[model samples]
Target: MKISKIKEYFSDEELEIRFKSSTNKRIRDRWHLLWLVQALNYFADDASISLGYSRSWGYYWIKQYNMKGPSVIVLPKTRNPEWLEKKVTDEMKIDLLDKLQKEPPEEIGGGLWSGPKVAHFIKVFYDLTISRNKGWNLLKECDYSITSVRPKHRKSSDEDKDHFKKKRAPKYC
Candidate 1:
């Protein structure tokens, strides 16, 4: 079995004050555990159990206090950075809505706003050039829907399917 010890510096009154004044319950108990070991001469493990903390809790808290004071009782905290910056702001949504009502898609993209058009619009208006999927997501966020109306090409082509079927018929069948 290994033996653990806690270093004590503050008096009973100071320890009680720290225990009462601490906002974090865990830190307050740490203070009490240190006090119990130093003032009462109780073993570190026993004090930790009486304080309802882990075996390492008393050792770590005492180590921290020895290094600093009551200020270093709480453990360090860390947080992850944001995943993405919001491109479609509320203001941008309002601007898009206002412009959409003023002009039709044909006037906007000569018939439709394709992926490239979306990229251009995002660059020109919002000043943020996002991908086609991002632009589509932005439009969808604003409850806007897009539909294709069968764009016509300038090239001439015969639409007679029955004429091709008769000529291409096999002699065996």
Candidate 2:
């Protein structure tokens, strides 16, 4: 879409001031897009390219401005505060930590507390149903990690020691 020389809803000076002062990159980028068109007279494609957004985004933002007011340009931050705490509570965390400190799953004859195992454990003990990923995250939050004991020589080489093949007598003959 063509960017015409529309009369300033907001002055270039005002947009520039807000763009400079705003901490949010979205606000700054949006302001820059408007300023590029209204003040600098840049094309939509050029403005989007300059601001690292798709050309369609530039047109979208312009449409957003036309439909609403200037406030629509500044995107809101994605806020997710209670996602983890809602699934795994603090009490459950303490209990999980205590369990990890005592014996590993193998020692307890239960195998390793993998993601699924941790999920089942939470369901049974804490009475909370959690996904495998959430269970793994809970274990990570408790500072627990999967460990195993295996004896292997560090410098062992993966090569045949002898090249000759052993000959055996045929049983049928």
Candidate 3:
């Protein structure tokens, strides 16, 4: 298949500046691809081969350049405000910490402050639906750690525990 000539968008000097100034290897390679095709009169396949990239990659970028111009290679400067907004605020965190210190509210049932309970609390009070994992993360952020209590035998006596502690305990330094 015949490939059409790439349109001149930036001059050789400008392309060289772009290629040199680029911090990302991927973007620099794209600029280098353009330089090879436009300045050195290299075919897309030849440019791809010279740049150690696949032919399809070269064609894809070339097609993008032809359709969208030079700005396609540039990174977006603006961020989405909605994405940047915090779902949980400082006040909510304070409230969560206080809630965790006490028994769970009646709506969620009385028990330990688990991930599901935390999530349910957030859903009820804050009007937000957070994941169980995020709830655990919140617990961790508040400096709460996981705990497990050892089971006690029904027939075991305090005298037996004292005897084991006094005699059976390891004495290694």
Candidate 4:
């Protein structure tokens, strides 16, 4: 099939500079496609094949660049979704951080602070039912670490503890 040549929107030097400077691989590939067609006289099929892209992929970007100029190739940097940011306000985060610093109230099933506990607290106070993972993320943001202390038997006294330690003393001594 016959393919159309890419229109020169920017100079070959400019395309070369864009290809070199672009940090995103996808953007660099698009720039390379333009550079090959406009600067090196490579046909769309060969250029796409060399770049490990299909001819239609090359055609699509070329058509976009030809019509929309250089801006079409640039993608926005990734960030958290707008709704997520909106859902958890700065005030709420500050409050959560403050709550994590203290003992949990009895109203929210008093216990050591944990992912599920934090999630339950949010649900109780903020009316938001969040996942345990998200709750864990909140704990991390608050600089709270989770740890477990060794369980002790209520019946075991200091004498029993001493006897156990004596029995288990290192043989090296």
lDDT of each: 0.65, 0.74, 0.82, 0.82
Q: What's the CA error at residue 136 for candidate 1, in Å?
A: 22
Model 2 poorest ten-residue lDDT run: 75-84
Tell me how many clashing residue pairs each candidate has.
Answer: 0, 0, 0, 0
CA shift of 25, model 1, Å:
1.0
What local lDDT does model 1 show for residue 124?
Answer: 73
Query: How close is every model to the real structure, measured as TM-score?
Result: 0.39, 0.47, 0.49, 0.44
- The parts of candidate 1 lying over 4 Å away from their true place are 1-8, 74-173
Evaluate residue 71 in candidate 4 and report its C-alpha lDDT on the 0 to 100 scale: 78
In terms of TM-score, the best-performing candidate is: 3
lDDT of 4 at 121: 87
Per-residue alpha-carbon lDDT of candidate 1 for residues 73-124, written as tens digits (9 for 90 to 100): 6553222123246356777767776755543344336544444555567677
What's the candidate order when arranged by decreasing TM-score? 3, 2, 4, 1
Writing each residue's lDDT as its tens digit, candidate 2 over 78-173 gives 343544454676777787877776554543248667677778778777677789898788777777776777755675554532333465777994
Residue-level lDDT of model 3, residues 18-116, one tens digit each, is: 888999898899898888888887889888878999998899888888888998866432444654563878899999988877888999877678788
The TM-score of predicted model 1 comes to 0.39
